[model samples]
Target: LLIMFFTTGSFADKIGPTDGNIVGRETDTVTLKFSYETSNEYILLYWYKQDTKSTPQFLLYKSARSANSERKPTDTRLESTTTRDSTELTIRGLKLSDSALYHCALR
Candidate 1:
């Protein structure tokens, strides 16, 4: 699972996906990580999954001062976390078909 970059022409070092590969077993866990330096600005973070057979899936969302993620279909398998300067999207109970292209978009 090679790491995927999900960003565009933004200011230097504002948002980036880590470079490397992510490998995990079925039912195991994996995290697609991202780092950001927002300079105390508030932003909405989202993680998405797009596979060959389905449309883009809205997995989770996080924003400033929010303790919980607003997930689509109320799924517990996917969730996101945010701190002062970074965020992570964790996939619990991974499956074989879960391997696909993922993007971490910020707004």
Candidate 2:
């Protein structure tokens, strides 16, 4: 499977995926990492997944500054981890349908 990843942020607030594309097999585990920098005390991040010819779907959102603040993912196999300078989306037991473009946004 092939997965593409992207990120959105302001000029000063640098953010992007560690890899633009990734290749994996079924049942494999993949972690897409996005590096970000911000000065605000409150940090919120959103993750989206877009399949071919489909609108991006909201996967989840997390506040890096708050450990207990986050939106649970619709899928149990999906997990997110956040830090002061980066965030990651981890997909477990990957399938062919998991192949898509992922976008991460920082606010």
Candidate 3:
């Protein structure tokens, strides 16, 4: 998947995902990792999950400097963290329905 992230002065560019799918079992925690390059600018990271053919559902987001993150009403088990060059989405208590297309966005 392509993740569109905003650049300086309102420009945007698309970054590619690290891989395709993450395999997991019921009640197991799984992590989806994304690797992307960015300049020395403020960045906002986002995480979402899309079921089957549905829209991407919001999970959470965090800034480059802030430790606090925000999640959607339905995002009870989703959390996000970032490193210098990568972002990770950690899902707890996996279920069969958790199988879906996961995406990460940056801005």
Candidate 4:
């Protein structure tokens, strides 16, 4: 099986994916990377996946630039690692159902 992903975000804020058209195979672990620029003391990062004929589903979110940050994922297989400038979403034990356009947003 093959899974493909893409990202979307605001160009004015300089936030989006580090790569586009990523591919992964069944049972493989894939990590999607995104970068953002913000001068605020804190920022929220979000991840979503959209399959064909459907809307994007919220997967997880993480907080950056704060020690008292928070994170939550909709699935146990979904995990997020975030820093002040970048965030990465890792999906483990991939399945064909994972094929979709993944999106990242900064706020």
Per-residue alpha-carbon lDDT of candidate 3 for residues 31-89, written as tens digits (9 for 90 to 100): 77777666745677787667766888777776554444455436678777777667777
Ten contiguous residues with the weakest lDDT in model 1: 1-10
Local distance difference test scores for all models: 0.68, 0.90, 0.64, 0.78
Q: Write the per-residue lDDT of candidate 2 for residues 14-100, one digit (tens) a residue.
A: 898877698989999999999888877688889999999999999999988754589989899999999889899999999999999
The better candidate by TM-score, 2 or 4, is 2
The best candidate in terms of TM-score: 2
Of 2 and 4, the candidate ahead on lDDT is 2
C-alpha TM-scores of all predictions = 0.75, 0.93, 0.73, 0.85
Residues 51-82, candidate 4, lDDT per residue (tens digit)?
88998888877888874465677578888998
Candidates ranked by lDDT: 2, 4, 1, 3
Count residue pairs with overlapping backbones in model 3: 0
Q: Give me the candidate number with maximum lDDT.
A: 2
Off-target runs (Cα >4 Å) in candidate 3 are 1-14, 65-74
